[model samples]
Target: MGESDATIVSMILAGDPRGLNRFLSRYGHMLAEYIRALTGDDNDLFSAVYEDVLVDILKQLRVLAGTHETPEIKKLSGKGELLRPIFESAARTVRRRFPDLLKASEEPKASPLPVDDLAAFANSIDHVDFKTLLEGLAGPERELLVLRYRLGFDYAEISNIIREARVQLEERLVNARHHFRARLFASQQKAMV
Candidate 1:
């Protein structure tokens, strides 16, 4: 956690209104990206989910800050422990309300690239190819990548949020990366024709 994060957490704990604003400013983009990745750019769903997440986070601020105790909140430390719980809570709420959004894994089809190509493609990824390839990924893979890279979450934190074992999460992430790289390689190959 940085000094700004500590200060924001402290302000929220102290019941300052500006704290919520600051918190929203800090995390709003990440939250937006998370919701979009999950819901596939459905603006209506995104807006509703965003509002719901904000409200939920605000309601639980005191508990998360450790001013009030709950089983979930009890595990939090005072420094910067509030963010994960808040994000996880919002994710769960969104998932519950939009179960259909989680069906990304049901898509049929596999990458054409063989296993040997994965490492090379991953190493050669450039920004343009990365975005194009990322969009081609299944929803779960995209979500996993976004959470790990964009959100700066470790495997442990991701496991906690996604409710999977750390080892399983790591395996899934590895596979997702392979799938993304393979897709990028295939696209590039096609463009050369």
Candidate 2:
């Protein structure tokens, strides 16, 4: 069986360098996906963020092992939980590095449909339609939805990762959902005609 997260963390804390390699081997793909989703598939930005995340992980190894009970590291239960704070820190670093990108993500252009029409069309849709509609959304919107639904992150976790207030994040998510439903409705209507 594969080593547990607790074992890996313990190894790293004990200064076994291979533990770092094991950690990266285990979580690298997830880190890459998270970075790619948030940065709109900008490979260059992804690389930078990836490196920063690694450095941060190494620097904060002790803290992540739950050395303290307050501030930053709360409790390191499993790999998934351990990654949350690290991802949030990496996101903050990336946002600072690319302020312009953050601005763009924050203010995506308005949809073509009128507000009333869009609202009227926003209804429950099938999975395939939802997937297509999600793809049609702007980068930030897609990222937000993916983080929430796909990754199972709560609003507080998402807010920390995106560096937005909880209320603002909620508004963005609502707008994203509306836009997705609107697009799906339009597509379905087009297919029926």
Candidate 3:
């Protein structure tokens, strides 16, 4: 979007390792947050899954380059196998690394904020909401919501990630919004005390 982003994308496409590092440093937190919420509240799980996701990204960079694509590229829907195994493996790793933390670090049950606290509302929520709410929606819907809102992806970007048409992705986003709104409202109500 900006000069630095464009430069970083160029470098990555050009096969410069530094570009990857710079990109990670710039966007890693957002990606981490998205992964954390997506994997529920298991921080260790998030870390492990993130490792796998990073590996996939690096592996795909070559494919991206061969196609002359940049970092800002999106994907179509139903493009690859679901990444559930990544999270499951991460969960297993967490179980091995700190067995005690498993029970204590159970995914949070609701969005972590008061409705009136705009700052807190912005800063407090994580992937847990979508992860927890996923049970209420289909797989595609969950991914759509996370990519579009939690990960700051636009329809086109999400289309890139999901490999779906932008219009279909847009519909998914709308449905995700409706579902998430209901879930978020319920969470807010429950948080009230």
Candidate 4:
């Protein structure tokens, strides 16, 4: 919905491969981070799933192409309905490709976070401040958090990706926040003691 995203979407619809690459570059770190949260240090699984997700996104590029002849979809609002389905489908592909990674691993070691707009994501790792707490959450809970926070997605888009009710997803996020806060406070108390 931001100006940059709108421009990038337009570029992609215009058949600008460079624009599509830039678009992906912008969200690439978040995507990698999201997957790392899911797969932990399972680099093999992460790489495979990540590639699959990208491939899926690339294929969906045609959808954004807005018809090879007319291409009016490029002129719409950047946050068009078309983008939602593309991202949702990509996330589902990732989930399908690697279902149990989060549950069966130690902390995920993500690929090098993309340098694109490093300033934007510089604090992402710290701002979230709940990575450890996330380890205890179920895979779906972790996935939702990654999508919402890391990927900058709203609940409706997240619902599309995970196929869950908005209310249920919101409740899960709230619970995860509370759980992490409690743990942080407990750790602080122990340190003070």
Candidate 5:
């Protein structure tokens, strides 16, 4: 059944059981991975959290099935359009049932997206702007950009790779961030002017 995400979402909202089964078959692993990401490697905790999050998701789907007024509902299309609620429910369930895990995860963690090094730059720029800025970075400065956004390898990993001390690697990243930000700020000013 190669139905589009919009079709599956509509089916779900219309109370078709197959709609939810299709959704779970499509995105179950994503939900599990998200739970794992938030809760860390407490392997057994996965089932408990997954069950709670699943229940929350089902409850949400049931409510949405009865909804009528949300104009945004009409705008949905791809799988991308349907995932927001599942993620929000997962986050809410983790917060409510495992407040400790949620609290600890609030501290910044490494991510696949290179946000820690870019810091303010990452926050202020859109994806195209970020790619443009990344293109501007060059030489060792480019490679040495410490990625501490999702997978946890920080300066130490970069230092090990480049044969620099952790302190030196961090300093280089700081310089790279400042240089990157200066270019971004200049571009913003240019656009404004």
Candidate 6:
């Protein structure tokens, strides 16, 4: 797996068109899907957003070309591991613009989100009780909660971010959410008693 990861990155960085072509052919659609999900699923804007994601990923990789990070990158588990940080950055910057961009794309037909909605969202998770409930969860479960509830990433993005299959992510998220809710309920009952 490490060899394949290194080979894939090396192919992209070695200035070999075949390597680039092969890499793109293998992962292009998947990356586009990741960007599309992050970009509000606007079909018309998919091309441009996908291009930006690819460029950002390539630029980040090129920066690693000569650095000591190249070997470490190779050691990553797979393509998803390589792309997790890039997707996280995009989720932070690009996804935040969705309400505005989607509205604009639809000729301002779509309703804009309230200005405070995002702040409210981030604050919704800013609580000790929520953090305590999260501690009872496993690593992947806890990460899924933070990624979905706190960062506002959907299951697709979380799937890629955590390198889990979408089906598996969905299952884990459901179980984790249910468990967390039960804990919260139990705590509330205790407080009242």
Regarding TM-score, does 1 or 6 come out ahead? 1
What's the CA error at residue 67 for candidate 3, in Å? Answer: 13
* Candidate 3 TM-score to native: 0.50
Task: Please list the residue runs of candidate 2 whose C-alpha ends up more than 4 Å from where it truly belongs after superposition.
Answer: 13-17, 63-79, 105-139, 182-193
Q: How well is each residue in 1-193 modelled by candidate 6, as lDDT tens digits?
A: 2235556677677776665676566556656544443343357676776666567667766776564356665575455455556555444434444334322211112223345454643455334376565555544455566667765678887877656699998997887787776665555444433
lDDT of 1 by residue, 142-176 (tens): 88988998889999888888788999889989988
**Candidate 6: where is the Cα deviation over 4 Å?**
1-3, 38-43, 67-69, 77-80, 92-193
Sort the candidates on TM-score, descending order: 1, 4, 2, 3, 5, 6
Weakest 10 consecutive residues, lDDT, candidate 1? Answer: 68-77
Q: Each prediction's Cα RMSD?
A: 4.4, 5.5, 10.3, 9.8, 16.2, 15.0
Pairs in steric clash, model 2: none
Alpha-carbon local distance difference test for all models: 0.71, 0.66, 0.53, 0.64, 0.59, 0.57
Estimate, for each residue in 1-193, the C-alpha lDDT of model 3 and write its tens digit: 2235445555777778887787677666655765554455666766776786666655554554454353333332221222232233333443344343323222223343445765544444552354566545543455556656665666665565545688876875776677666676565455443
What TM-score number comes out for model 5? 0.47
TM-score (C-alpha, index-matched) for candidate 6:
0.44
The candidate that wins on TM-score is 1
Angstrom error of the Cα, residue 30, model 6: value is: 2.1
lDDT, residue 49, candidate 4: 79
Model 4: lowest-lDDT 10 consecutive positions: 104-113
After best superposition, candidate 6 residue 112: deviation in angstroms? Answer: 26
* Superposed model 1: Cα runs more than 4 Å off: 1-16, 65-80, 106-129
Model 4 Cα lDDT, one tens digit per residue, 146-174: 77776678888788777889899899777
